[model samples]
Target chain A: MSLVLRETALAFRRAPLLSALSVTTIAFSLFVFGLFGLVAVNIQRAIGNVAERVEVVAYLKRGTPLQAVALAAADIEAFPEVESVQHVTEQEALARARRDLREFQDIFQDLETNPLPASLDVRLRPAFRDVQRAAAVAERLAALAIVDDVRYGREWVEKLDRLRNIAGAVGTVVGAAFALVAIIIIGTTIRMAVLHRSREIAIMRLVGATDGFIRRPFLLEGILKGLLGGVLAVGLSYGGYALIDAYLLRASFFTAAQATLGVAAGGFIGLVGSLVSVGRHLRST
Target chain B: MIKFTGVTKEYLKTGAALKQVSFHIARGQFAFLTGHSGAGKTTALRLIYLAERPTAGEVRVSGFSTARAGPREIPRLRRRLGIVFQDFQLLEDRTAEENVAFALEVTGARHTTIRPRVMRVLTQVGLAGKANQYPRELSGGEQQRVAIARARVNDPVVLLADEPTGNLDERATRGIFQLLKDINASGTAVLMATHDLDLVRSMDAHLIELQQGEVVYDSAEDAAGRQPVAP
Candidate 1:
């Protein structure tokens, strides 16, 4: 170890209270950053997972034949965006209605024949499961001569898309904000370290020590601060991830909670790294 | 050797403290700068240390003109000049030996060379046995002696003392002067700024008196106590 390192060790040994406070501040800030990070990650994952379940339903004309419905289903399945297609015959539709509304069967008892329409259930490929793709597939299917109508939870899907966009944008902004905060916190922490040892700096100047040699101790000090804060933040964030995931699982929102925790860890790392570096530099000088 | 020509230093509130002052000290020479308070003695000493640049004129020390000295050369110059202050600014936490070793450490003195050199200087100042003691544990006289040991560790070409004995008793003051005289006899020039007229008179050394800001009397006292170089 160089003289400054050796002396820096002595300086730390002499002032436990001051060093502990600085490190604690770093850890606390990192923990907060980690929490926000978790919120963002899970939102993204939940949006993606939910989008995969969305699909379009195309209803055929009331008198359409089984062969026509089957051919249409096969044709729809061949589309680049379509994942798969299932043809529902009028008989199947009637049976489903009978099972669902057995008590209301009297309301339709006067019907001479079932007027139920056969339909094609189109599941789009995962890449096209978003609102735009779902809407486009519905429009395209409705344009077909054999299709009479197309339907889906249009407003709900639109709202989900909007929410996903807003959430993703917020995640970006929050990540940037945390990064900036980490830099400021580190810089201020290091500045405090510098102020603490100004006398030693003056003495170093008097003793014919170069500026580079004088700054070494504080740099080491900042790194130690970062490492301590980093370890704490990482440790705390891991616990937070587990706790949040467990709560989400119990509440049946596990997917979102899991996704968000990943962001939390990233935030923790950023917070710890920036502060320790800045703190050490500020103190060393 | 040192020289001051047409040197002037001033602050806005405290007008000119040194004005067009001119003096010179030759190689291996000792001098006393005697003055009352606020007589620019501290300012004069400060200029030699390159702590304050002069408002005017040329001041030179150890062959380099300090007025024209750049930042890089300042440390080099300081390494060659030993300074002792009235407050005896020793690190209170360090051993007497460590305190002395600081001077050598800064100048890149090897660790193996520090121990014996520190011991020799402490022995010279009659503080050898107390090397392991910290400054706070020592008496005022002993602390001053430790300060002297620190100054001498670098084997500086010139030693400057500013009221070194202000905090000491009469006998202690006498001993401090004797130590300075012995160092000067061994060839390092000593410039002491003091108000101890009784001590100055008994020592029989060259004397320069400054009142207000300018020198009023210049008696370059030889070893036998007579003005040898008249200006």
Candidate 2:
């Protein structure tokens, strides 16, 4: 081992209790930040997953031609905001209506000629699915020739806009708070290290060691603590997400397909955020 | 060689610690700096080591100006000379060999070269058997031996000792002096600052006495006119 690393390792080993104290303290602070990082990621992804349901539905005119219905769906898909288009034929619509009416036996006397018009369900790309953007898309679809009505959930879309805004605001505030807390904890930990090893530093200085060489090991220790803490926090948050997912599936609501889709995105965010925080701590003091 | 020209040191809180002091020690010369307590003995030693910048006047050690030496030059200047503290200043956590090797390690010696050099020096200081012993395991004089080993490890051109025998008994003091004499006999300049005036008188070595930061006597120059003292 090089002398600087060897000396740092020796010093740390000599006082394992103090070194462990620094590591765990740094880990706990980073853990809090990492957990929040995961929460924010999952929240956005969940909202996004549910928000996919908010699509512009182009209801066709009564007695509209088969060719016209297909043409309308195709035209809607051509819009930059539209992701995919599905054509619900008149017969299919009638069957679905009949199934609904069968639940209330008194309402459906008979399944006669299908009166439900064929409609186009147009799912939107994530960026254009916001309430304001979705409304613009709906208006543009209504302007189409064969569209009898351009319908998307005005109230539902508006509610989601509000909810998404609230989530974003909460994420920002919590992120900043946890960031401050983490920096303070790490700073205090480093300052404690400096104070404890002041004598060692003074002697090293006396022996011609530059300031940079002296500070390197402490910085490495800080980074290690942060990375380990990030792993732990990710584990805790994943466990929490898993438990929630399990409960949802047990109650016959959302399934495993729902959570796994967002897991990769969430994990990426957590790892990056933890690394950035640790880097900031290392450079700051 | 060290040359202090009109050098004066001041402590702001106490003020005027050392008056304008002037002297020179040539290459491979052994001299003793004798003074009373608070007579600027440590201050004089500090000037040569660049431990403290003089409050006024210029001081040069081994041709590097103390007042103007940059960061890069300071280490190079210090590498040429060695200074031992009065308190030994041995790390309590390190073995005697480790303490001696610290000097070489700081100057960027290769790890392969350091072990052998540390061993050779420790053996020279009579601490070869005690290389593995920690500072607390050794007595005051033995610990001082470890420190002397550290000072001379890199084969410094000049060795400065500040109150090195303060904690030793008469026998240990004699042993330490004999070691210093042996090192000097090999042509490495040795300057020991001490309070033992009787030891100074009996040794018949060159002596320079400082009283209140001014030279009071010079044995080498005064003895030049008198009959030469026995070797």
Candidate 3:
């Protein structure tokens, strides 16, 4: 262990510029990855919120009895996909219209009788938030005897769902690509370090040093670089998140668990990279 | 002790580097391997340290058959032997003391044991006061001494030197030869490979001469008035 430490210290001392460059490259790569993660998390959260608000509005027929309207609502609520049903009376619908369009309030006041039909607002469970599923539920509601028509923003919901899928796919692909690049960068850096100390390694081998003994110091160096890079990335991400949160009055995009996971991933990448580079060199020698 | 029996080394690119060469050095014995360039002198030493396996036959160093030693066993076998190079392959950035200590360090020696042993070897090589000097700062002879110190630091049962004086002046060569002789006096068997006939004749040590991967002459056998067939 002391030998590993000494060798690592000597390596850094021998090539400070190279070590710094490696660490910087790793930090920048991890920072970009973390930034993408933050964006993906925020986008997913926004999509979830939008999907939760999707509901089917079922209008009641004119002169429908109050008891019939309540029965229709109860039947809609019994659907497996339905989460809840809210009854909107004609008077309440008129009042909502008045609140939504105050400038058109004069037109509603001039009406002799309430022409607005009562409606049943049907909210589906989160699993049934797809455009096709909601449309199917709306069709079932529209068949009710007391229901006149059923409407849900199928086109808009489909578009939003597509957008969410695209975001998720792009996030995964780009994140994986970034991680692969980070591993390559780290492996190349460690390879350079090993090359720089090739003579030392040969001498060690001559003196009965096992492959593990010769490789430990370099592995430690790679891990240390990875750990520092992770810390830098985490710090930058946290600071950026704090800045965004402060300016936009929004909650953090990355959870504590995600931050920890990111750091762990960085360390793991460094270890794998080191192992690959060192193993190749050892095999060749 | 080191022994090679009908050892042959074949390289795909260059063919045989050593061919059916056989010899033996008893415990605490000192011998010289002398030959022209590409005469298998270095290859013979390499086989002793398990650097090259015999394409045929066997090599035994300190009672371990190098040809049969597994990967995990090779390092342990090497720990019982020390090797010196023609270029005096010292770590240029490290102090002489550190270079010597590195040998022990690789063997997982304790810190307290390593320090005194490193100092003792440096002193043995007459570099006690220059322990802290880097290879670049030291003279050619001092650097060579550092290499020797590193090799001797572990008190290996056998010391293999390949052209140890190839880059040294007459003064440095004599000093290094004397050091090797003194090291041998301390009971470590030494196998030194060189083409310096004058030094070999001067010392009159046991000589094994190779020619085109074949052993042409062995002094010990010659002293017994026996001639072995050369392949």
Candidate 4:
């Protein structure tokens, strides 16, 4: 173990330029991947905010009893997907309309009787905010005897669902492509490091060093380089995020857990890349 | 002890490197493997070290046979034998002492014993005073001495030298040959491969000469009147 550490340190000292080059290469590659991840996370969040507006509104018939309406509101709130059901009285609806649509406030004030209908506003749970779930809840609300009509933005909800699916598919496919590129580029970089030490490896073998012994130092070097690269990559990604968030529209960065996962992913990639690169060199020699 | 019985090595591109060759070296015996560059001297040494397995037949060295030596067994076998090359395969980044200590380290020798063992071999190779010098700072002969010290540090039963003096001038060559002789006097067997026929004539060591991958002469068989050679 001490020998392995000594050898790894010696290798870095022996070829600092090569080591730095490989680390920089890994960092840039991971930075690109991290940038894409940042974009995906922000897109998902934006879609989530939009999905919060997907609620079903059920307008009651004019003569519906307050007791019946109250009972119906309690039943709807009991549904598994229903987050909350608020009942707005006719006067409250008129007041809300006057507030929301100020251009029509004059006409609302001139009216002798309230022209608005009392309604139940149904907000679904986050997970149930998609088009199919909203439509299903609307169908149930329309079945109530007191509900004259129910509206849930069917076309708009369907369009949002399509956009969400497209974003998800693109995120997965593009993320995978970036990850593969990082592996190949990082693998080649590690291979160069192995090749640089080919003479030392051959001599180690001649001196009766086991294959496992020869591989340990290189593996440690790779992991260290990867870890450094990962940290640098995170720093670079943050710099990029800061630029965009400051100059452009508001954006979100990775959560702490997600950043840690990105760094761990870098280490994992480094380990795998070193394994393959050193394995080939050992096999060939 | 080392023995080769009908050992044949075939490469896909270069074809047969050794052809049905057979020989044996008793414990603590010195021998010479003489041949032209195209002959199988290096190939024979490689077989002994398990660098290349025989296409046919067997190579048995230090209780490990190539036929049965798995990946795990190869290192064990190699630890019992030391290998030297014409290029003096010392790590340029390491000092002479570190180079020698590397062998003992690989064998997982006691940490307390490593410094003494390395110093002993460096002294044996006449490089004790130069222990801290890097290979690049040392002359060709001194570099080769570091390589030999590294080879000898493990207390191997047999030392295989493939043109150990090939890169040295005549003076250095003679000095290295004498070093090997001194090492052999310490009871370790030596198998030296060389194209230097004059060096072979200077010694009464056991001789096995090869021509184009086949053994053309064996001094032991000739002395025993079992096989006759043209010259």
The candidate scoring highest on DockQ is 4
Tell me the lDDT of model 4 at A211.
92
lDDT of 4 at A150: 99
Clashing pairs in 4: none
Q: First chain of model 4: TM-score?
A: 0.94
> Cα miss at A77, model 4 (Å)?
2.5
All candidates: interface RMSD: 2.0, 2.1, 0.9, 0.8
Query: Model 3, B77-185: lDDT tens per residue?
Result: 8788878888999988889999999889889998889999999999999999999888999989889999999999888998899999999999999999999999999
Better of 2 and 4 by lDDT: 4
Clashes of each: 15, 0, 0, 0
Q: Is candidate 1 or candidate 4 better by DockQ?
A: 4
Regions of model 2 farther than 4 Å from truth: A97-116, A225-285, B204-231
Indicate which candidate wins on lDDT: 4
C-alpha local distance difference test of each model = 0.77, 0.75, 0.87, 0.92
Give a tens-digit lDDT track for model 1, residues A33-63: 7667656656667777787778798989877
Arrange candidates, best lDDT first: 4, 3, 1, 2
TM-scores for all predictions: 0.72, 0.82, 0.88, 0.96
Task: Give DockQ per model, in order.
Answer: 0.35, 0.35, 0.74, 0.83
